[model samples]
Target chain A: AQSVTQPDIHITVSEGASLELRCNYSYGATPYLFWYVQSPGQGLQLLLKYFSGDTLVQGIKGFEAEFKRSQSSFNLRKPSVHWSDAAEYFCAVGVWGGSQGNLIFGKGTKLSVKP
Target chain B: DVKVTQSSRYLVKRTGEKVFLECVQDMDHENMFWYRQDPGLGLRLIYFSYDVKMKEKGDIPEGYSVSREKKERFSLILESASTNQTSMYLCASSLNLVQGETQYFGPGTRLLVL
Candidate 1:
């Protein structure tokens, strides 16, 4: 079965600090990975995606993710954290062939920014 | 922008009552999916529809039924709502599996069964 793991359930960082949320996926072949952000009581918003090509992929809100095949991980990173960036982050893996666009999401990591 | 809208933001229903959650997408997407979101558990697919009147069971299809009579609308039905079914329900749409791998999501509907 395909699965996504987000190791940190909750992570707190100071404002203006750097942020990196770990994500690993369980899949056989080359995988399509994505990162999403969700605010309280709101749906998820796409952060970044890694389909193919360069290991590093950039997304909206000044977010980026890197796909590393050897580790089977696609981690999301941001240069500087902002108060507005505090939210729950999800890492998802996109299926191919049968359910090409279907996604398997991680439990999520809640990020709290300190003032 | 591709917009996916849910019928309600929050719903409260009594146990044994029939529940219907509606979803609509404006992008004329070919695939529509329904998922349940839990705290510890990630989003679990309940059901999906590829076309009008066509549906498929997802990972967690038990205790739920779906109807897709129209192209852009998909509805999830619970024959008898139960207390354990209280959770947030999310709807998503995509053009297709291969062409559109990224799915657009709706705000979600929080269902609380009493």
Candidate 2:
């Protein structure tokens, strides 16, 4: 079965430090990938997506993710972290097909930025 | 900008009561979906519709049902609300596969059943 995994359940880093959240997926074929962020008491917002073409995709809030087919990974990264950036991030894989297009989401990784 | 709106941001209901959660999107998307979100489980699809009046079961659809009488509206119904059904319900909309669907989510309704 196709599934997504976010190994890190939670990560804490000092403000202004670099951040990376790992995501791995298991699928039979090349799949559509996405990153989303959800702040406390809020819905998820799309951070970036990888459908085709350029392996590196940039998304809102100065976020970027690179899709590596060989590694079966799409990791999200940011150069510097902000206190406001503390939120839960999710990695999802699209079940790309005809009319049954839906997403398989990872458990989620919660980031907490320290002062 | 695409806007998805849920009827209630927070709801409290008694157990065994029938519950209705309404969602509407203004983007005129061809597909709409209802999902339940828990603390550690991320999001699980309860149901989805590719077109008006067309519905399909999703990963966890045992305690829920859906309706899509129009293109932009999708409603999630809890047959008889249970304590275990307390969750954040999210609604999303997207285009068809031909258009390369990317879901847009609503603000979400946090339903609390007691």
lDDT of each: 0.91, 0.91
lDDT of 2 by residue, A16-46 (tens): 9999999999988769999999998888889
Tell me the DockQ of each model, to 2 decimals.
0.62, 0.55
TM-score of each: 0.97, 0.96
Q: Evaluate model 2: give its lDDT.
A: 0.91
lDDT of 2 by residue, B1-114 (tens): 999999999999999999999999998898898999998898998998889999999889998999899898999999899999999999988876432357899989999999
Tell me the TM-score of chain B in each candidate. Answer: 0.97, 0.96
For candidate 1, write residues B1-114 as lDDT tens digits.
999999999999999999999999999899999999999897899998888999989989999999999999999999999999999999999888663288889999999999
Candidate 2 clashing pairs, residues 3+ apart or interchain: none
Question: What is candidate 1's local distance difference test score?
Answer: 0.91
> Which window of 10 residues has the lowest lDDT sum in candidate 1 chain A?
A94-103
